[model samples]
Target: MTVKTAEDRLHDVAIIGGGVVGCAMFRACVLAGARTVLLEKGGDLLEGASKANSAILHTGFDATPDTLEVTCMQRGYALYRDICENMNLSVMKTGAMVAAWSADDIACFPAIMDKAARNGVPVKQLDAQQARLREPALSKDVRGAVLVEEEHLIDPWSAPLAYARQAVENGGTHLCRARVESGVREGNVWRLDVAGKPAVRARVVINCAGNHGDLVEAIARPSPFTITPRKGQFVVFDKTASDLFRTIILPVPTALTKGVVVTRTVFGNVLVGPTAEPQTEREFPTVEHDALEKLREAAFRIIPALRDHDVTTAYAGLRPATQFSDYQIEALPTDGWITVGGIRSTGLTGALGIAEHVVGLYRAHFADPSPLANVVVPSMPNLVEERPRPWMQPERGPIVCHCERVTEHEIEAALTDRVLPAGTLGGLRRRTRCMMGRCQGFYCTRRVMELAQSHLPGLVSPTGKGRSDV
Candidate 1:
């Protein structure tokens, strides 16, 4: 609960953007015993592309071999496993099936397996019959599949919060509604001009702004690379349809894309679609009517039975992609500045690895060569067990959302949690399951909004009073 003064001007490192990468970097800095400041323009954390992703934990099974991305993903998967276990976060290792429907796709499987092996990912090829037995929902035309036992599904919302919470507990400052307008290096320190706030002086600044990475880099004039926002749209199927698949079913990759896939979320809901299309950074993800139809057609082709399942929601997320296929993490000549770009789709799975890499860069390039002391930061209690949903904790059993089985108590906790503050009802619904049901907040919006307003007063009116309805 310690808040730094606007004019205080103190921090070892300042991270712009509060997305998964930025939050992860903040956590890494904290763990490395560096005083860090995490700045976000959104009212709460994970409000950007991070919260709306497909939430699949990639295993680098198809990533280009011997690349920085592949290396990071492999290390990240192990790190995530440790963090998930320690924090009691929701993550399901349901495995993954990369199925081939045609001769060309089948031919590509061996190459993919080779690539995975080079990336140090364990994968085994399965015959068509074996694939069908593993995932009966798959189409009969399937030629074969590569079973990646390590790839998993995670609750995207919880993962970043876990990192942010751990960072805050470790004395890192997480400031929301604080946007960095521009920054520059003056002597040994980097001074940041935060929107509507006083300037902050820090020894180093890490650019982890996701879509706005280029803009942040532009603030200092020249940058190594530019970022382009690649949009991916997805459809969420009802939890009742969860039985359609036991593992994440993926389509063989083409030269341009990874194709569409079906997967079961940790919340027991089935997910489909994730059509990647190039788009503007200002444009938030939304399902195009054509995209939705294309997704349905592709999904039906993979699992004909999926055509019968009810789709609960459709959304999109923007991926910060660069011209390079591999990740770009390097220090700038202008003292105390680093850029983390080209995260692409593997970002979620590779976040921790990226953080660790950035920390090493700080030690090697930015910080002095003096040996740093290891500081032990206390971790937050696991909320997954203590505040389970009504269905999970039957004593509090009246379901508010029949489709998702979200409850009132869960909504209350989401609105009140310190680390992942739910400023709006939609935000609360994202954090908890309160209003993300088939009704789509029709039944619970009012109550959830009321609770959110009560818990986060200023947040309910992010634009002051004029746009109170937001």
Candidate 2:
């Protein structure tokens, strides 16, 4: 019989959350030669704000001038290609446009372009005729627009999954369903307790707990900031609307929201809405009919042709808004805990730079670090519309999920993939795009679950909290 250790070994750093930021922190620590461990309360990954996020890779053109968001967003945008290429994540370089439906919106173009320049993003100004010629689906009343040439659409869930996979393969540890209820420092080490699991001890603790970041910080020490949940609801149109545009159609941003946008996903589906409304219930991801109508109106005003397409699905995402506008990342004096909070909407675009920032804080805490060589990047199976299906090439087994073109081989890989196995339908969807198409898995859910049960026994149940343990 194999001997199991009585307790887990102490790590150099123990990150509290498994969201994008936390996974990025874990990857950074591993790259910087730190023995890091990531603890997520969920059974899988991306359970919070990261789950329902719009898949747009922002250009930070409209970020508030001279803040951490602008700096990190700029870096993230620039680093996007290199990172995605190494990890095999699909990214659509289909640029973006901020459409002006009114004279006021038209007047804001010059200022918007100026702000884009300040954020180190180049944008082009287009007149109404010029805009109409580019996208015939756009509304006839569009006066003018500002084109952000670098804005791209990416696979939103892939980055976190890839980062976590890299960290684990590179000697970092990941604990799913390991929630850190409390942490206390004894001498030079911080001990963290997880429900129904061994206590994880570390010399440094970093909190990347998304919307519950404040709660995670309170577990170790008092929180310096409060995270107010801001809900943004969105509607996705079927891939039949792919011709609507090859780029993102943005609106004049307000102080609080990015306004609703009609943008293409990497898989060719068009997404609309993301109506920003402040809410306190993090558990409720309910979509409002009124908000759905408002988002539809917004999409229709920009692209009238969008009205002809069927609404595939609608969902909501929460952003961690705080009293301060910029991100709150600081090392606390009490114990070795650093808080990463208030990342809001830009978290997806800024994931890499935020990792660097947290790594710098990690170095500041321990003071000794060594330069590490290039970490191996794992190649992911492409799920983009353009990529040929497994059945198209090899004689893979019968197709399982017809809605998204997911095949049996692909489903098996998702079920047994070493990086992050799919234990739930949601997790499987994120991995293989199963059950997310127009039919919404009505045709394939049962067949897929049957495959899951055969390949990944005891792990394929659909649940309210998803597959993640936290």
Worst 10 residues of 1 by lDDT: 377-386
- Expressed as tens digits, the lDDT of each residue in 34-129 for candidate 1 is 888999888777777677777888878788887888878878888998877667676777899898888888888878888888877899999999
Candidate 1 to truth, TM: 0.92
Off by over 4 Å in 2: 1-7, 454-470
lDDT of 1 at 193: 89
Cα deviation of 461 in candidate 1 (Å)? Answer: 9.7
RMSD of each: 3.3, 2.7
lDDT of each: 0.77, 0.81
Q: Give me the runs in candidate 1 sitting further than 4 Å from their true place.
A: 1-7, 368-402, 457-470
Q: Give RMSD (Å) of candidate 1 vs. truth.
A: 3.3
* lDDT (C-alpha) at residue 414 in model 1: 70
Model 2 lDDT per residue over 1-470, tens place: 96643237878888888888787788888889988888888766777788888788888989988998888877776776777887888778788889998998987878898888887778899999988888888899999889887788888888788888888888888887787887778998888888889888888888888888888888776788898899989999989999777978888988888888888888778898788788788656789999899888888888889889989988898888988889998877557878889999899888888888778877776645784676777777788876665767767778887778889888888888876786555677888888888899899877876777644434444432224222
